[model samples]
Target: MLDARLKEQLRQHLDKISQPVELVATLDAGQKSRDLHALLQEIAELSERVTLRTDGDEARTPSFAIRRPGEETGVIFAGIPLGHEFTSLVLALLQVGGHPPRVSDAQAQRIRALDEDLHFETYYSLSCQNCPDVVQALNLMAVLNPRVRHVAIDGALFQEEVSAREVMSVPAVFLNGEPFDQGRMTLDQILARVDSASTARETERLNAMSAFDVLVVGGGPAGAAAAIYAARKGVRTGLAAERLGGQVLDTQGIENLISVSHTLGPKLAADLEAHVRQYDVDLMDLQRAVALVPAQDASGLHEVRFESGACLRSKSVILATGARWREMGVPGEREYRGHGVAYCPHCDGPLFKGKRVAVIGGGNSGVEAAIDLAGMAAQVTLVEFMNELRADAVLQEKLRALPNVQVIRHAQTTRVEGDGSRVTGLTYKDRDTDAVHTLSLDGIFVQIGLVPNTEWLQGGAVELSGRGEIVTNAHGMTTVPGVFAAGDVTTVPYKQIVIAMGEGARAALGAFDHLIRR
Candidate 1:
């Protein structure tokens, strides 16, 4: 038992302190744990000025009201509260210690009135700066609403969870156990979505239309190529895309694309769009194809339906949708993207000149970016989740030779750390030793693999390979008559932009042949 005088002294000392102090205790079975708890309780009782709470088995605390003595508010966190976790604890304490961060009056009201419980799980890699703003927005929401529980898992730290969730992109936000948003989203946009989700009617439906000579689905490289070719060939082409430029728009440069030595993705896409405009192709920007109806007309035309209640009739169809980048799927990754996180080194690397940066993955793209950025950035850290880099030996030699480059093998990105505005560093865990370490950097580049954009066409008329690529014959003819596929979407064995364009040109010719034969 502690003496009354000692207990009183502890209480007096606690009352004098304004800031919150988090007590982090590691779980150990052999140690005298009961004594620690007893001391904590004694301190809590003697000092009416302090609040003491225990982390439960689940490492989470239930939402409860907390009022601190001599303070206007109180904050609570149920965790070990070490390393990066310590920062979160301090922020919570500050908020509860009568200096809560201010939000817009309207945002505060929206948060206060929210009665529903919202759980947000954001998957991210530390290398992606674009992820942080979304994470900040969600974190702000969590701060505003007690009903909102937000947990950021470093995708690299929790690979199994990431794979299970099928998260293939950084800044992927899951709301109420389902993916709600991906990439950077504004706070107002998120709030609007939450509001809409609460008040919107479920049965709301739009009118449908059916009828085109060519229905080009997707808006990426292949799709755009097909649209341009088909429209130029005098076909009534209707091109639908969720976003113009597809995956290529997110890319930084087109060095590998023939004829374009070092053009930006947006610029390349703009040129392609200009080419498409020269013809009479009907381009549907920000439109998604929800379904494909088989050929209903006697002339073998296919009916393609869009989510916007718009439809087009076409005798021939081309699937040109490209692929998507695979994600690191770590927590705090989605929330911190764009703020301090990033993916495309070519696009954002120059912005971080003479600054520290890290590249995740060991493929050709990853190695290439590291080598390229080594000349510009102050430091380049290359992390390969695998035991060795899969890049070509020449590139590997180049990366190894770079003085500024440091390679971390058998490591995976776990989390990204930053202010609400920009990325500052990243965390990683060793796959073999399970040792976790944080590396300070200004940027992160994800060079993971890509998944083909074929999920929408599953079980459709188009024949797909085991890897989800569209199966095409030598002439680019799909299994369905009058339908052709090209670019990376087809099983062409090569994913080069030149190959895709060549395939697109071939598909256009094949479509013409089908039209004439019919």
Candidate 2:
């Protein structure tokens, strides 16, 4: 049964509906279905604009939808909109009843200008806060454009579709059967990608390009250096990357670039891009390498195909594919990722100002993150699984010097606790004593390790480490004759901007060596 007081509040919200909406509920005669039906009946009675209709069809049982009077299509509600997802139903009603969104005028214009017929199929979980952002953004786009349609699928209700799409997280948006986004994103970011992917991320047949001397597969410091080194020899060099900055964009400040006292990630990214443009490197930005086809013809040109169906051939491929942050793999971690549990301290740290937070891991990065968070959050708790902190002694001392910081060693994070909307705290257990404790905090930052982006390189038969990092030798040479890897993506020890840049130079020189001899 609905809470009496809470039901009154929802009833008042439903009373203000501007248009007639049909709550077409299809529920079985089962006990659980009966409870939902009774709730819907009670909800409908409170609002004159809403009408309830129940269908006891066995196949349609447990499925329902909200349809406007003049609309042929409506938002489907496969699962019960309880708990956090109750707000989704509330917003859906408001938007369908002709309420204007709070989007900027510029964004509205961009959305309205989308004249092509598009359908967005977004999969979401009930507890995920980030999922609502994506769902609302796409719904707003559909509301603004007549040519757009949206179907929000609850992952729990549509298990078959989720499995078929290989969806591992919430807010997995699919446009035209292609995965548009795998995680949380802002509307502006979504629009920007749409602009970039208008001609890219396509699956149509691509015209093969002529052969190139060097092909750099990443766009980080390493890949940029590889391109510069290859082009310095006056050879035809090409670079393909999904993003210009690789993982550098997530970095807030760069103090170790040498000669540069202080610079931001975007600034360094722009500089690297401008530097690459000064040369004759074939820059294929926003293009992902999906597969690497072995040389088929006598031209000795290996092929690198992109998700956009565009294929480029090169005599040599230098893989500087970067890495992504390793996850905590705890319950509620993925669901409340953007909501309160974050991996990027620089990106999401500001949101926790004046709040209490926790940082996982005791390495150099983790200690630095704790120090960073101590400035923003009222108090910072640094948790490490090891008995002793792994960070340098100086860094550990610096972190301990903070008044608002606490260090907890030999602690293992057990679960992320939340109120179904946002994270509220984190629970951990002592490794030695097996005693559990919960810290009441607003956010948790996981700063453990990094996993290389070598999944795409698997198709090319590139040798990889047990951790999935591309394995390379001293000269950055892979097992394949014309293949090489560098940067955090490789099995190189101590990943740093300087180390990556040097590796990229070596890989290019190796490729140059392979070419001059051939």
Candidate 3:
């Protein structure tokens, strides 16, 4: 199952197992089952503390459970967890074997103290980069709390279950057979969802925080750079964001970042967070800013309020809330977001394997998505509003070479059609002939562009552009005296990650200058 290099790495990782762990598999005579059996056998050979058995009674064939001998199983995998989930498999083994997880003591205690009998099942795809985080988080929770159990099912391998459950997205989590979440979620987010009182505890903690010298209102590349720069200047820095990694977390490949030839989005986001942590910055993840209140005088602190009613005061503020995926806004698109309409091609592409799908947009993202989907999807229709594709020449060439792909230029997506359960087709109109057409598809991927997350600042103190981006000066200072802006949320010409980081650094410096002048 595993190559020599992977087997050696697995052996080294499994060597850290401090307690005995058993792999009890229940598999049939199918090829997938045999493959899983061979994989399990190979895994059991990697470490002395690990053993394999075939006496389990799991209903799902080609599935296995990882647990201690004579103990109730807490972790299960319904398919071969290779690809992006290989790390998840390794972590599950280690955690179930009594090795400590890489979480804070309080987090670990919270997980262990959960008294509810929670059973989590996550339907994931092997190629999805976002699925591993959710899978690993649930797996860790299961390992920590005996009452909690998790089953990670590969949606592609279990098509009947995927179809029966109406799961068209990756990392779709169900709690005790009911829908819980539908996207990438961290351990803290999951805990908050399950533990209702966790939010109040967090709110109190946040409300008690002292005023900061520089407050960054986002956690993307821009916010991270600003926080790091401000903290390095020996100022009290605090960063609060809806999601720390922001849009970058949804990104797949990033080869254009300077000094780095190639890197993955999650890896780069982790590195950014780690770098910011090297400073004395207060990191507040998953906090969304609802309002920004500017100071009345030079001595007064600017206040930023969150959805939890927690307010944080700062001498200077940097707005870098970043952006989100631009939706099609057509009818039925919202109704079938998870059912069929997906924005992330890499995350949700596998669920539509051998099914017809459409890519809306003609930019690099759309072309790339079409190219990626052409390999798995039975038929891919690329719809473009422009007469010609705007993607790079190389990308356009590759997209045109795909046999199963059909390019539709000068077409506007008018509406998304679904059968209430899932997407069945789409409605579009030709710009030249004004003729309406429909496409039969199992999924639709919208990759037009991004919309700045500046709606919260609409009636705020800062000046905004026509497109809703915050207006900023050359020094990254906003219309407000002590407040600055940067990155995708601001009036920046480009929305690249490297440019965002540079703008964030500049905004941090500008805020520092304002503070010293005051």
TM-score of each: 0.55, 0.64, 0.99
Q: Per-residue alpha-carbon lDDT of model 3 for 1-518, expressed as tens digits?
A: 89999999999998899999999999888999999999999999999999999988887888999999999758999999999999999999998898888999989989988998999999999989899999999999988888999999999999999999999998899999999998999999999898878899999999999999999999999999999899999999999998888888888899999999999888888888889888899999879899999999889999999997789999999999999999989899999999999999999999999999999999999999999999999999999999999999999988878899999999999999999899999999999999999999999999999999988888867888898999999889998899999899988897999999999999999999998988
How many Å off is the CA of 338 in candidate 2? 0.8
Stretches > 4 Å off in candidate 3: none
**C-alpha RMSD of each candidate structure in angstroms:** 16.3, 13.1, 0.8
Ranking by lDDT: 3, 2, 1
Query: Clashes in each model (backbone N, CA, C under 3 Å)?
Result: 36, 0, 0
| Clash total of candidate 2 | 0
What TM-score would candidate 3 get against the native? 0.99
Per-residue alpha-carbon lDDT of candidate 1 for residues 291-372, written as tens digits (9 for 90 to 100): 6666855476686666555566678888777787767788767776754466776445545667799998899989998998
Find the candidate with the highest TM-score and give its number.
3
Model 2 TM? 0.64
